[model samples]
Target chain A: MDETDRLIINSLQGNFPICDRPYLEVAQQLGISEDELLSRLQTMLDNRTLTRFGPMYDIQKLGGSFSLCAIRVPAERFEEVTEIVNAFPEVAHNYERDHEFNMWYVLATESPEQITHTNQAIEARTGLKVYNMPKIQEFFVGLHFQA
Target chain B: MDELDRKIITATQAGLPLVKKPYAALAEQLGIDSETVKQRLRNMLDKGQIRRIGAVPNHYKLGYMANAMSVWNVPDDKIKELGNQLGALPFVSHCYERPRFLPEWPYNLFAMLHGKSREEVADKVQQVVKLLGEYCVGYELLYSKQILKKTGLRLKAKD
Candidate 1:
């Protein structure tokens, strides 16, 4: 929540040019040295101030398909179910929500057919129905958090 | 388009450094020149491999108390028009349409609305309903109480 943290947050939300010395370019814009900027980022990551730093792809546009799926995993078997679902490389993220459909996750695959196959495999592995919710329309895309 | 580009994307997904010469530092890590790092980033932005390079915060921590995932059932034909209109709204955050999981659900288009409270989020939904008009057959709202994981994408490197 310091001035430096705010700057880092703001800079992350904005467009970063794909240049050779992109960090240096960002540093110049913020009037800082490239080495200093890099060190701060490393510190942030090491300290868990930032969870991750990477690209977010438009999987649909990339000819891959994805769905938001949920399952009513009983408390007794939650851990077992989590393991089964998380085993797939396609399961991008999984979460435990406070609802009957407590186990929720996202699966991105090369095709819609893959989505169905993956769901069936999950059901067979866990004996729970995987509610496959594929996006029907896009209402909003980007989420930029102002620090 | 090469191994270096993939590495750079993986390295700087969260946010760039906050120093005077962040690129120089990145170059040092990648064993490349600062100029090389800078140019690659510019290219990635142009190619849409990376969307933006900025801080993504935990909204719950920011006092935005309520966030709801609102799903709508719009006729297939009017989906694009309604999506564009809804996407323009300031309150809508993450929006997309998914295939209908029948028997239990029929909604399609989904938009996330965040506000200071549940009532505030409801007001935003009311605004969306007004804008969407009668074309919306049904809608459901799902509130998020916990966020398990929110992270950036990692590009697979070519061998």
Candidate 2:
């Protein structure tokens, strides 16, 4: 990633314009042409520098639900269990953490009750306990990383 | 959201097209005008249904390899004040108050700290420790070993 790439990452994290020529407007602000900005963004995304490039929807506000769930898989079966847990379409984000609760993932469902439904399905499949840690309150969410 | 809005979301949820006229592309796909597509997105943004429209970078790939979810056991009454303070910190990305399962899990406050290395993360944790002081009964830094999956917020399409 060059200086221009860094500038693109930092500038476009949020508040991207909603106009017809949004990219053109952004490129102007960053002192780059629309074509250059588009190509840079495409390359960054292709290389996994930017995991996603689009609108971030608030699932809860849209009558959907989200819960952070974890599981403790035996060391030997970690990989197998990961495959099993991740097979569920509802498991949006999963991670291997350094703790007893080694596996952590977020479940995004269409409704509040689906949160429980998905957890139960995972437990039934994995035969391991799923700890659901739904947020009682959200204090913050947005954070920008200077690339 | 109406059916048209849902169609717009389903079309762009993956991403805006990498084209000169991205919204127009979406409109073309949905068989709607560019103006309507832009207006629905704007409306969703206004209603907070859409947080923002932009790039979501991979922090690990961006050199923020050391990201720790710092969980704290703080008194329920003090959480409101403490969570806000932690959230205000530039390094802390996400902060929230969650339910704690005693005996196994005892963390009510969760703050995500990002850094270039574990040492940097530990240093930030110290800042949080000092900020919490006596209110924090216990804490743990769960460093992620791997990102197994990270496809953000996918809504299943209607049948």
Candidate 3:
């Protein structure tokens, strides 16, 4: 990435303007034309450098529940267990980590009750205990990656 | 929290379109005026329903591929103070206080760190360790090996 690309990513990490000509406003600040700014963002999105560009909604506030759940799967049954856990659509992100609790995933459901239901279904299918580790509190959750 | 709110979310959850007047385009599709769309978005932002409206860069794609979930077992009383300190660290993108699973697991603080390499990440982690010093009883860095499934919130496909 060039200096301009880095600048765009850093500047637009949050607080994107909400107006008829938001891009123009951002462009004015960045010392570029609206078309140039828009095209750069477009290219970044298309190339997967920027995963998303928009409002990040809080699912819990929207009557949904999200939790970080983990499982310890034996090496032999790792793929099988992953498949079983991922069968549920509520599973949003699943990762393989090098730890006793090898498999970690985020469970996102429309309702709070569904989180338990999904856990039950996962345990029933995998025959392994599911550890639901929801956040008790959030001290802070805002950061901008300065590229 | 109404039908219109749901529609607005489902419409803009993925992201706003890349146009000069993106809200106007969204309003046209939702059969609402540009002003209403803008106002509702502002309301959601003010209500904390929407964290922020902006671009989310893929750190991995941006060359900071080595990432680790560095969790710490901190004292309950000092958790908030330590957590705030950890959150303030530039490399620590996300910091939170979670419940401790005694006997088996005992981590209460979680901080996500990203860097260009594992060594870089480890170096940054040492900074956190020194910063937390006596407050942190124990800690572990769980580096993700691979992403099995990484789907962001999908409001429309499920519907």
Could you say which candidate leads in DockQ?
A: 3
DockQ for candidate 3, C-alpha atoms: 0.81
DockQ of 2: 0.73
lDDT for each residue of candidate 1 in A85-118, tens digit (9 for 90 to 100):
8888878877776566677788877678998999
Error of 1 at A10 (Å): 6.2
Instruction: List per-candidate RMSD values in Å.
Output: 4.1, 2.1, 1.5
Native A-B contacts reproduced, model 1: 0.48
Cα lDDT of model 3 by residue, A1-147, tens digit: 788889999999889999999999999999999999999999999999898899998767777788999998999999998888778889999999999989999998877799999999899888899989888887666668777
DockQ class, candidate 1 = acceptable
Question: Cα deviation in Å at residue A21, candidate 2?
Answer: 1.5
DockQ of each: 0.40, 0.73, 0.81
Each prediction's Cα lDDT score? 0.72, 0.90, 0.89
Checking candidate 3 for backbone clashes, the offending pairs are none
- List candidate 3 segments past 4 Å from native: B156-159
Which lDDT tens digits does candidate 1 get at residues B47-133? 776565554555665557787778789888888889889888887778787777675667778888888898988898899989988
- In Å, residue A134's CA in model 2 sits off its true spot by 0.8
